[model samples]
Target: MNEEEIPDKNIFMMCEALNCDALTELPASYSIRSCRPDELGIWKMMPFDDADSAKEYEGFMSNYFTTTYSGKEELFFAKTLFVCDRQNKPIATCLDWKAYDEFNTIQWFKVLKKYEGQGIGRALLSIIMQRLEMCDYPVYLHTQPSSFRAIKLYSDFGFSLLSGDNFGIRKNDLDECLPILEKFMPKKYFQKLRIINVPKEFEDMVNKYDTNQF
Candidate 1:
């Protein structure tokens, strides 16, 4: 999707601990599996909300993979996952990535608009968190106000908005984003949102990166 389309403030969230009990099985007829080398195209286009957006983002996604995960293609595919239909076609994808080789961060998480409202995204995220359980604490993710649904889901998994106007190389828009969420999201979901201090270690690790290559 085009950046201008959403125009929402970007925000950061962190899960200091995994909420494994929140994990639930995918609904019948769908399954989760590691991404395959041959399915790179499927992974790239998974983030767009629909087919038209996917087509518009195809080239940009291709280059994003090239520039961001360049030398780590094998590991990237290994850490990435797909939630597929009975036919084994990917309907959603996410990555348990260690950005800058320093800290764990969720990346490229999305379920096709058509398949949403199902339990696919929750199942996929649970599996990713299960995998990260052994890797590190305080997992982080970048998102925006436009993704309030995802923010609610992330909150269910113990992720809270990271407090501050800046996080590493990126500006934190949580202050601005929260008002939007309060206005649009159900009051109950909005009430459950939490804000936590950004971990110093995470901040230091990220600030070391001179550029936001990813």
Candidate 2:
């Protein structure tokens, strides 16, 4: 039967199976309490040694920061957690704490697509907030103005927009116009400020384009 015709029980089983398959693909040592290996083929389908080393390194560093720090950093790390299906595959993801002290920013948020909305996003957000409450840090995040659904979710969870800033250009503002033009313009007319480390042919094409006037 087609997806819409499938019974809720079957649909849930399918979703559970998909999640379990995903978990098996997770990196070694990652933990999940809800999903177990024997309940599905999760362990057999796991990535083995084929997983990307870079991804493993990133995970290691994140775990290290959480373990090494005791104060804010530790709290931030605790806030950042990942949950996957039985296969250890990530269906939804979020960062619990991201802080740039110089910029006075602390962002705790999740980004999930429509198809992955099986209440996973809400559950992940709730976990972050629970950890944050213990740490006593105010939680905040940034999103596009177009994200009405996300805005509503945040509002329902007691977040409010403090201010808004316009990003694009406006014609009437001459002061803004000058800066915009200057920002986009080349310095010394033909001088290249950055270079792409590509093949010789690509570099030659870029140089040729740089010399040609519009």
Candidate closest to the true structure, highest lDDT: 1
All candidates' TM-scores? 0.90, 0.38
Task: Give the per-residue lDDT of model 2 (tens digit) for 1-214.
Answer: 3322322110000000111111213233333233232322222222122346435555544453444333564344344455565665644444544333211112323343432446565555554444444234334344432333444444444454432122111112222222332343344321321212223332233233311110
**How many clashing pairs per prediction, in order?**
0, 13
lDDT of 1 by residue, 1-214 (tens): 3334556577899998887777988888998888999988878777876789889989888877876788998999888888899999899888878788778889888988889898889988888888875458778899898888899999999999998656666888877777788876899999999998888877777888765533
Candidate 1 TM-score, C-alpha based: 0.90
Residue pairs in clash, model 1: none
Off by over 4 Å in 1: 1-6
lDDT of 2 at 156: 43
Off by over 4 Å in 2: 1-79, 102-108, 111-115, 134-137, 164-214
